[model samples]
Target chain A: MSDRDLIIDRYKDLLKTYLKGKSETALYKGQQFSRKLIEQQISPDDVLSDHVSVLHELFPDMSEELKDSFDFLLEVMIGYGFAYREHQSLRTRQRQLESEIEVAASMQQTLLMSDVPTVDGLDIGVKSVPAKKMNGDYFNFVKDHKSVSIAVADIIGKGIPAALCMSMIKYAMDSLPEQRMQPNLLLENLNRVVEQNVHPNMFITMLYGLYDTDLHEFYYAGAGHEPGFFYRASEDRFEDMFAKGLVLGVSRQTRYKEYQLRVNLGDMIILLSDGVTECRTSKGFIERDEIVDLIRAHMHKPAQEVVESVFNELERLQEFELRDDFTLIILKRKV
Target chain B: MNIQSCVEVCNEWDIVSARQLGRNMAKELGFGNVDQARITTAISELARNIYLYAGNGKICIEAAEKMGKRGLKIIATDNGPGIKDIRKVMEDGYTTSGGLGAGLPGVKRLMDEFMIDSVVGSGTEIIATKWLR
Candidate 1:
């Protein structure tokens, strides 16, 4: 025999030794089985006949029933191999999807204002949670010694585009000098910029406000934003500051409306995107009043706590994840 | 049935509701998932612009069959004030309010078709479409 044939014979002798007196025919059949046969490397018809004849030599009394058993084992092994290949493919696909989601989440995070600007006598806190890997809502605080600007805008849609738009809005706000303090003038300029550059159909609902810590006053402009809530600790009640304005990016000529409020000690200002009010409950949708009550319940808490409490309540009421991005900014004045 | 729907209002809370309703309508009409997301986002951006810059305006979401496929058309109209310069507004990184200035341009990218009509004093109307083929 050639050296290669000698190696095959030695491999068969080892198999026979391992199966001594324990079904020699089964061992011989298993040892001679070739996975390559099923893969069409060898003829399927000749594979079984040749392997069986080799096994019959090892066990002269071995029955045909034993040969059938060997065939079944080979079939099972092929099925297992196919299943393993499919499982490996699924695992690879899952890993790829996870990586994509991670990257998207990172991109979305970049759209948020990284740090809150510092202003005297003011405590501000902001929080945002996306329903998916990306968010459509954004908030930012821009400040100088004279005044602090707080902005909250919700892009009309979700995902990477919204995230990119959020970044654009942030960069625009960062480039604006303090001289552009007037909310209306600022929004007007922003409108022209967005209308000219943004997709013809995209727009933004924003509430931009400049708070003068020295004067204890807030100058605000609203463009398609929701009615903000102000809590008067002295009165122990909340009032809606429903300023009106147009959405951003519709027309270059559109004018924004401006409003003002005097900040007092122990007063709290709450700004939120539609996701807060539009959160759906098991029975139905969450009413605006319920959100107000939630704010009231956590009125005495810190600004951060107030924001977290509201989100917690929303989560408790809903069985499923929030359908939209949820964001909130709380501004509180200390005595 | 052939129908056209349009709304002109400030980009405010109510208008957002309008956009959401419009999105639902588009979905009911069997718009593709990707197309529906694009139209909804585009409409929201336009409505928001009307509220933010124009102070008040309106938006219209219309549906029609085009090329044997369902198509959604969105038009946002505002008379608040017209853009000073359309070219400047269309340019990226040029914002008056320190915002991203990405709203309009971003919407344009999301849609399959886009068009804009505006006058400095009159107002602006944007038309965009997503076809479910």
Candidate 2:
């Protein structure tokens, strides 16, 4: 090869390094070398052409094989760069979606969360877990002088629509006057609101209970929801607390029946979404007896610990991946 | 055509699944929306009966054809305490539990054929079949 060819080869090596490293020093040196090549009357395009020839010279026996090797490699690198750009954009989009869900979840959590009314003579504990980013389980506490009203509802569906319905329930509940002390009245009113506003396809199973400390009575109603458990300390037995009512949003005029329970000292009232009792075991689903047994074991603890222990035990039974929204509320009557 | 589906009716959520299974089978059997709705409602009542009385049970949904006409069949079985009086249960407003008492009679009215076999201590099995016109 001629002296000019050798110089062009050196430029090719330097330019490759400059492109690879994106090094400013390599770029500056390359600029200086290009200027020197210009000064010496050598063309830069000739150097690029010589780069291919250099490979050909190295593979003299395979000259024809190496002929378009550099161009092919450059083409492959350009395709790789396009794919890399696409990958980066996808990653960015994924991150944005994840963060958006996080924001929505937090916002929904705030909407679902309410101050557990610290009523006199009652220790209340509540917990909720969504199987997905959004939960359909709901619980609320509204208190007056004589009674603290509690509502635990599970939407018949999941995701955003259920979340929206839950908000509707909260507002409907707040719109009621204080005269709606009766659980049956509260549920009836709430059902009317749901039936009028929400889509017919969507429904809710709810249990509304108003515990009157003054009367030592707990008035409760159920709208096709799972029965809550009442632990009678005096009898050393469990009584299922349930009332007859259809699911909300089914009919506008549907009336819920109310039942009364005497909330005795040391007795416990537990309300849970079906997710708690329907926790999928290897067999299919956990039995209510198992749930009662677990609660009985933790009956000695505070309301908060009862919820925690029951949740932990149920989660263990299901291997920690809850497939539905879990909502539990425990109200303990202290002596 | 005999397409069948079996689901465990343990809780209220399972009752919903059982209802859906009945409707879906009806849909597959080419039943119209009204029939499908009736089948779903019947399944809901029956499934709730299993859940409320038995605590845990199973429901089988099947699509059947007889004399060149298609139909749907539902069989709900539970090991729960058997009903002492099947005839009384079929009477409207006869609820042993806290239910609305419209379940058994409502189910019987919804289907063309209904049969129940129950023993006091053993279990209860109710089968209902509806034929498409």
Candidate 3:
């Protein structure tokens, strides 16, 4: 006999023994048989169908109503069987996707690794956190003689695609030497690269800024990115630093406008992604003024501590669960 | 060709049921494999939005006839917190739930006709259609 037939025979014997007497020995044998059935990948509907067939042979005088009830149960089990299979397959796919993403995320971290350069007269702080394993936000700093350049970018997509695009951007930016010092030219060149290489459906928003230590001037440009804040320490007030330009990858001919700000002693310039300003809370999205207030509350701390404090506060407001990638950078003039 | 199927989307199983029903309807309407996949993907996204954001909702797939063309229409309705900013949500790379950020805009790209109406604190309703070519 085939394995299925043997199983059916054993199942019939077990059912007959159990029906004769509701004994503990028969229940134990039935449990053992069930394990075998499970090992054979037999579904519940198949087991019910086998039970009905055995019952028909054992009790030849069974009523049609009783047989019909068994058929009804078998039909219900068939639906249950399909749903169970769908659930199992979906779970398997989810696990596989999650592990693959985890591997990609770690590889991204290794590919885009960079150190925060130490520059005199500038207290710089930066942080980037992803809500998921993969991050769509990117930030990099390049140190030049008597100056430091910062680039904060947000990709319009997520997953492996976003990570690959970011790595490409990292390598592309690393190849340029003089362009890094000029915010507008840097963005224009990067925009052309993205437009030519990346997919049309994807776009990138970037904020590039260069701080000249000797001249105490901060030059910045934006490509449809979120506007940051310039904290005037002398006036004890914050000012909005807005720059308008098209997002990258839209057009190769797009030109970016550069803006300059005089960084006085103790003044601070904050550059961040929309994840900071658009933080959702129980009430709604936290206002820009609230973020300014948060920075003001931590103004007395060091630049690094200030960024950390702001991140912690915002993270708490969201119940320690970030919905999107969060990136923040602060450049404070200490000397 | 009378097709009017409704699936209550409250959990994961409901999403599966809704998307399967959508694919069946699309196949019944003589849609090709590519269109069938697109319709099912759009239905999955809409149903997931209901499950994730609204907590519970309903998806209705129906055969539509407008003018001289025959199409498949999908309607997803939810009485959740509703959308705070419809314009912002439609923009790419904008996600509040940490997904692929391809929630609504992705669905819009898959369907030929899409319309969404939402009011904060009231509810949201979306209607999308893909005509057989």
What local lDDT does model 2 show for residue A191? 88
Worst 10 residues of 3 chain A by lDDT: A79-88
What is the C-alpha lDDT profile of model 2 across A155-182, one tens digit per residue? 9889878887888888888888653687
- The C-alpha stretches of model 2 lying farther than 4 A from their native spots are A1-87, B1-133
- At residue A266, give the lDDT of candidate 1: 89
Candidates' DockQ values? 0.01, 0.01, 0.02
- DockQ for model 1 equals 0.01
What's the chain B TM-score of candidate 2?
0.92
**TM-score, every prediction:** 0.54, 0.56, 0.61
Q: Best to worst by TM-score, what's the order?
A: 3, 2, 1
* Structural similarity of chain A in candidate 2, as TM-score: 0.76
Q: After superposition, how far is residue A212 of candidate 1 from its true place, in Å?
A: 0.4
lDDT assessment of candidate 1:
0.74
Docking quality category of candidate 1 according to DockQ thresholds: incorrect
Candidate 2 vs candidate 3: which has greater DockQ? 3
lDDT of 3 by residue, A1-335 (tens): 78878988999888888988989999999999888887776756567777877888999899989977875676455544433444444466689879988888998887786677888988888888877787889999888788888889988876567778889889888877779888999999999999999999999999999889899999999999989999998899899989999999999999999999999999999999998998999999999999999999998888889999999999999999898788888989999
For each of the candidates, give the backbone clash count.
58, 0, 0
- Tens digits of per-residue lDDT, candidate 3, B5-95, equal 8999999999999988998888888985446666887898899999999999899999999998999999999999999999988865567
Clashing residue pairs, backbone N/CA/C < 3 A, model 3: none
